[model samples]
Target: MSVILHLFIAILSLIVLLLFDYVRKIQFYKHAAKIPGPKALPIVGNALRFIGKDSSAAHDILLDIAERYASPCRLWLGNKLFVGIYEPEQLKTLLTSPKSMEKASLCSLLRPWLGNSLLIAPVPIWRAHRKLIQPAFNPQTLRTFVHIFDKHSKSLVQKMEEELEGGEFQVGSYMISYSLNVALESTMGISETSDSKMYTRYTECVNRTMELIMVRGLRLWLHPDIIFNLTKMSKEFYKCITWMHTTAHSAYDTVAVSLQYIMLMLASYPDVQEKLYQELKHIYGKVIPENLSVATEDLKKMKYTERVIQESMRLFPTVPFLTRKVVQDLEIGGYTLPQGSTAFISVIKVHRDEKYWPDPLKFDPDRFLPEEVAKRNPNCYMPFSIGPRNCIGSTYAMMEMKTVVAKILLKYVLKKEKIQPILTIKQRVEIVAHPVEPITIEIVKRLPNTFNT
Candidate 1:
C-alpha cells in the first residue's frame, strides 16, 4: 500500500510541473501573438542572432526594420515583443504616457554603474532631480563659469603648442586631454593640479563601466549564464561595479572640478577662438578668479556665444538613444503594439535624418541662427531631449561650453591643419558619448589686438 501511494504522488507532481510550464508558455505567446519578428529558436529564441555584434546591433536591427516596414513596426525575441516607432510624433506619444510606457528593465543595468543619477533616473526621481539641478544650469549661473572655462581652454592650447611645436598636427589627443582636464576642474571646483591619481582612476572606472553597459545590454538576448560563464564575467564584473560606486561617491566632492575640465575642452575651436577672449575681457576685465561660477541672470545675455555652444551639442549629443516600454495595447503609425512592448527613439538617427536637416553632414553653426531656427521643427532637434524630462544640465552645459569656447578663442589662434587621410573621430558609446580618437590641432598664441568680436 505504501509503494502504490508513493507512485501516485510522483505522477501527480510531474503532471503539476508540466501544466505550469504549459501555462507560462501560453501566456507569453498570447502576449506576443500580434507582434512581428524574426524566427526565434525553441529555447534561445532570437537571442543568439542579436548577441553577435561589435556595435549596437539591437538598434541597428530596429533601424533596418523601420526602413523595410516604412512605418511603425513590430519585432519579437522569444516571448518578448518590441515596437519600433520611427517618427517623432510616435516618440512623443510614448514619452508623454510614462505610466503606460515605462522605462525598460535594461536601464536597471545602468543603475549598477551610474547610480540613481539624473542621467538614468526614472519617473519621480528623474523629475525631482531635474528640477533641483535645472536651476544650477540656468543662464545666470553659467556666466560665473566663463573665467575658469577660458583658463582651462588656454591651458589646452598650451598643451597643443608643446605637442605641435615643430611637427605635423594632431588634434585628437589634445582635445581628449583638454576635455579630461576641463571636466576635472568644472565638475569638482578644483585646480588642474588637485589629484592625478584620483582622476586617472575616475577615467578608468567610467570607461570600463560604459563598455560593460554596452556589452551587458547586448547579452540580454542570450540565455544569461551561457554568455556570463563563457566570458568569465563573474569576478571582474563585480570589481567593475564596486569601482563604479566609488567613482560616483567621489564625484560629489569633485563636481565643480569636472565641470570646469569639460568646459575647457569644448572651447578649443579655431573658428571662434579669438572672439571668445574679447567677451571674457569685456565681462571680467583683467581681474579674474582662479575658480568661477555665474548667477542665472547673466547667462541669458550671451546669445551669440550660446548659439555656438548649442551647435556643438547638436553635433555631439551625450546620450544617443532614448528607450521606453509600452504598458497597454496601442496603435502607432498604423501598427498595434500590445502592452509590455519595448521601444527606442533613436536620437542619433533623428539628428542625422536627411528629411529634417538640409545638408546634415556639414558643420555650420549659423544653421541655428534665430531666423533659421524659427523654421525648424522643435522636436527635430533635441540634443538634450525635450518635455518635462529634458536634460537638467542643458543650460549649465551650454554655458560652460560657450564660456570655455569664448575664453580660449580670445587667447589663441587654433588652426585646423592640412587635410590628412588619417584624421578621424570615432564615437565611444557609454552613459555619454566620448571621442574614441583624439582631436589634434595647431595652436599659435594670438596677439592682444589680433581679432575682436
Candidate 2:
C-alpha cells in the first residue's frame, strides 16, 4: 500500500510539472504552429520521428525535411523548435548576426566532453578565447608547423607501406592517426612517440563520445540529465572525455576528419591526382619525395592542390552544419525564427545545392579557380564556416593538409581499382562527417627521379 501510494504521487507530480511547462511555453508552441514542418504529434511533437534511427539515418531524415520545405523550415524535436536554414543567403545572415551568438540547446550534449571550450563556450568566453587563440592559426605561425606536418606525412607514407601489397584496406585509420598526431603536435605541442598509444586513445575517445552525442541529441527523451545519467552511453562518454586529452579534442578531431575526406577524394579522381602531381613536379624537380623537404613557398605554389582540397570540402564538408539559438526574432526568407528557436544552418544544403554548384554532385577542382569562383555567390562556399565565430585554425588546417598531401602524392600514386563514386560514398556525421565505410586506396611508389630538383 505504501509503495503504490509513493508511485502514484511521483506520477501525479510529473504530470503537474509537464502541465506547468506547457502552460509557460504557450507562445513557443503557438509560433511553431504557424511554421511549416514534418507532421508533428500532440504532446510529443515530432520527436517520435527519430525513435529507431541511428545518427547516419537521422542526418538523412534531417536532409529530407530540409529538402521538402524551403529555407528556414520548421522541425520539432519534442517540444523544442528547430528552424532549418537551407538557403545560402539565410545561413550567411544568421551566421554573421551579432545577436545569433547563442549556441543551440543541443550543444549541451557536447558540454560535458568539451567542457566550456571555445566551440561551446558562452559568447563571452568564446570571444575571450578567440582573441587568445587567433594568433596560433595565423599564416606565420602555421608556416612554422610545416616541418611537423612533413615529418608526419613521411611517417604516414612508411606506415602505409604495409598496405602496398595487401588488398584494399580501410585507410581512414592510417590517415586519421596521422591527422591526430599532427593536430596534437602542432596545436597542443604534444610530441609524437613511436608507439602512438596516446593517439589511438585520443582517436577512439573522440569517435565514441561524438557518436553518442549525436544519438542523444536526436533522442529527445534522453535530453534530461537525470535520465541520461543512467544510460551506458553516458558512462562511456564521461570515461572517454575524462580518460585523456582533456580539451583540444574538438580542434584536433575536426582537423583529422577533413584530411580524411580530402585524401579519399584525391584517390577517387586519378586525373586530378596526376594534375596535382605535375604541379608538385614542376616546383620540385628530380627530388626524392619520401624525404622531400616541404617549404611554405612550395605549399603556396601548389594552387591546383589547394583547389582539390577546396572541392573535397564542398562535396563532403567536415562540419556539416552550424547551429545557433535565435535571441531576437530572426527573419529568414519569409519566415520568422521565434526568438527562442534554433537556427539549423545546413552547410550541406548550400554545398550540394545545384543553384550554386552546377552538377554539384560532380568532383571538379576547377570549380574553385579565381575566374570560376568570381561567377558565384561568396556565401556558397564555407567549409570552415563564416563570420566572427568562424574556425580560428582554418589557415593552420589548410597548411597542414597541403603539406601532407604534397608529401604523400610526391611519394605515392593513390588509386582504387573497384571503388564507389565520390558522391555515393556513405557517411555518418558526429561532430564531423565520417564515411560509414573506410576510405581505402592503394599507393604506387613514385620513382625518386620523376620530379627534378
Q: lDDT tens string, model 1, 295-361?
A: 3344566665665565555655566666676666666665566656677566766666667768765
- Report the Cα lDDT for candidate 1: 0.57
Tens-place lDDT digits, model 2, residues 1-453: 699999999989988987897799777666767778788876677778888887788778877887888877788776678888877678788988876987887898888777788788889999998888887777787778899998888888888887776756777777777887787787678776666676677777888888988988888778899999999988898898787556455456666777778877777778888899899889998887765789989989989999999998998888888899888886678667778888888898889999999998899999999999999998889998888878777777888889888888887878777757765787787978888877777777776655421
List candidate 1 segments past 4 Å from native.
1-49, 56-71, 75-78, 128-161, 164-194, 221-231, 247-304, 418-426, 451-453
Clashing pairs in 2: 285-451, 285-452, 285-453, 286-451, 286-452, 286-453
Off by over 4 Å in 2: 1-23, 246-250, 448-453
- Candidate 1 has a TM-score of 0.73
TM-score of 2: 0.92
What C-alpha lDDT, on a 0 to 100 scale, does residue 219 get in candidate 2? 82
